[model samples]
Target: MDILQYEFIRNALIAAILVSVTCGIIGTYVVIKRIVFIGGGISHAAFGGIGLGYLLGINPIIATIPFSILAALGIGTIGKKSEFGEDTAIGIVWAVGMALGVIFIALSPGYAPDLFSYLFGSILAVTSFDLIIMLILNVIIILTVILFHKEFLAISFDEEFSEVVGVPTKTMYLLLLCLVALSVVVLIRAVGVILVIALLTIPAAISRRFTHNIKNLMLLSIFIAIVLTITGLYLSYIFDLPSGATIVLILGIGFLLSSLFEYSIST
Candidate 1:
């Protein structure tokens, strides 16, 4: 309780909730559409934006937004239009993004003191500005989901049928990936680039066991994410462990328990 008195702790809690909501919403779509690989690609590619931010002396999170969106668009376009396989596109984008980050960091002329935080996450380091960014992105994500719920649902379940029925499946898919990009940027502040995909997928995966309805899934996922993240935050505070990794571990444990429960029910 006393730990809540610290501004960073308070900010971390807020960031956790915001991140949970964003990831829960977008992650549901990612899982349903089977685009986890593309999400991973966008997240790793965002590293280039982080490096560029360091080189330019700006906010890395902000830089990651456009950079991640481009990666998302590129992956979506190349996978659909080019003869290359989707896996190939993801691999190329992933490697190029990581390579660019290394190059940018090397050219920045100063040792990156906080690079590890961006790589693995440091929830305690979240600032007021980061909270605001998370809040705004949350608002955008929620609104987008609300506005296009039916279209997104249609495309996620059946792109060919959706298109035959006159839904703009391609546009909606690209937009979905872009939303995924934004979610990656928002999550980067809490879980970093490397572990971002796990955080994005795990809660939603757990929630799927309880509900097939999209709205309920998102709500349950958000609730589950909030619980796991805050629990992880408390444990980290008590033990002085890394918050991001701790949260991910907690989520992994939650998944294990859920799987066991599912198996028991099946048997």
Candidate 2:
């Protein structure tokens, strides 16, 4: 309660809520489409963007957006057109992106004092500007989901049927990957590139265990994510733990508990 008086805390809270919304919407699609690996690849690839921003002396998050989008598109194209397995494509891109980021940072002149922060996250470091960017991205994601809900639903359930019915499956898939790229950028501030995929997928994965309906899944995932994030923030403050890791730990525990509950019910 006393922490709320601080500006940084308030910004972190707002960021958490915004992130929850973005993740809830985008994560639902990622989970239903079984593209969790793609999300992971995009997140790691975002590191390349961060490193590029550092080398160019610009904002890392801004650099991450375009870099991640390109990585997402590349991954999608390679997976679809090449004879290689999708996982293999993702693995290659994942390694190359991380490697590129390292090379870029190494070539940069000065010491990257904040590099670790981007890798592990520092929610307390979020600024008003970061919050504003996150808010706008959240709105964009929400509106996109609302506008393309039917198309997304059709493609997620049956891409062949969706293409047969003239839903432009390829275009929709690419658009969804773009949405994921945006979501990765949004999450980088809160959880860092390394842990973004966990934050993106865990809540939605937990929610799916309880409901099959998309709307219900999104709503539940948002609720769970908000609770876990806030709780993790509080715990990190009290116990002096890493905020991002704390949040992920809480979500993982929730998943285990949910799994146990389901097991009991089935038994």
Candidate 3:
């Protein structure tokens, strides 16, 4: 295999780095609280955003902002106000969002090729414009997470007590949903909406088997994601494999291996 010095390989690596920041930063809470389904729902909801943008002939990522927020809000509201675990609420939101996206696509005038790209991801085509949006969103997400670190920590570890201590647990949760929305948008292009959730969850899940501190886990998740992403990109270049799938598969394998290693240690 030629040493991966190519321009496309460089672009894929850069894009994956951007993805690590967004997904790894926010995914900590999702994995801790076991809200993995929310990741899937919000990503799928992004498709509805894409369809809406297609019908309006606007930038899909820009159009996706509001829809993604609404989807997040919907997930939180349904999970909280209604009688259901987050998983069921997320499932409902997932189905509803995809339903709307398909309807909007049917209503659209012509074929917009970007939809499939959003669905399955195309790392080779991540643009400079996408990078700027990614950086801006990265700033917003990281700052918010850091500023509210204590409060989020309290909520993530113990919601009942945080509410008792007046942490406004519900509000914190809503904000978390919003953060997931932003992260999903940032990641969709690199890993695609379908596989983005796996990338978000698998690293942290694997990392947690070895660490408990949320801060350490977040750092470890970022490290694991970057490694898998770089490896996947290199493999894609050498073997001409699909980038997103390869990356996600590496993440899954990492999780399995980590779990086994931890189990062996315990035994």
| Clash list (residue pairs), candidate 1 | none
Per-residue C-alpha lDDT of model 2 across residues 92-183, encoded as one tens digit per residue: 88889999999999999988998987998888899888888888888888888899999999999999999998998888888899999999
lDDT of each: 0.92, 0.90, 0.83
Q: Per-residue error at 3 for model 3, in Å? A: 6.6
Q: Residue 172 of candidate 1: its Cα lDDT?
A: 95
- The TM-score values for the models, in the order shown, are 0.98, 0.97, 0.93
- lDDT by residue for model 3 (68-104), tens: 8899999999888656877788888888888888888
Per-residue accuracy of model 1 over 175-221 as CA lDDT, tens digit each: 99999999999999888999999878999999999998899999999
Of the candidates shown, which would achieve the greatest TM-score relative to the real structure?
1
Model 2: CA > 4 A from native = none
Better of 1 and 2 by lDDT: 1
Q: Estimate the Cα RMSD of every predicted model relative to the unseen true structure.
A: 0.9, 1.1, 1.8
| TM-score for predicted model 2 compared with the true structure | 0.97
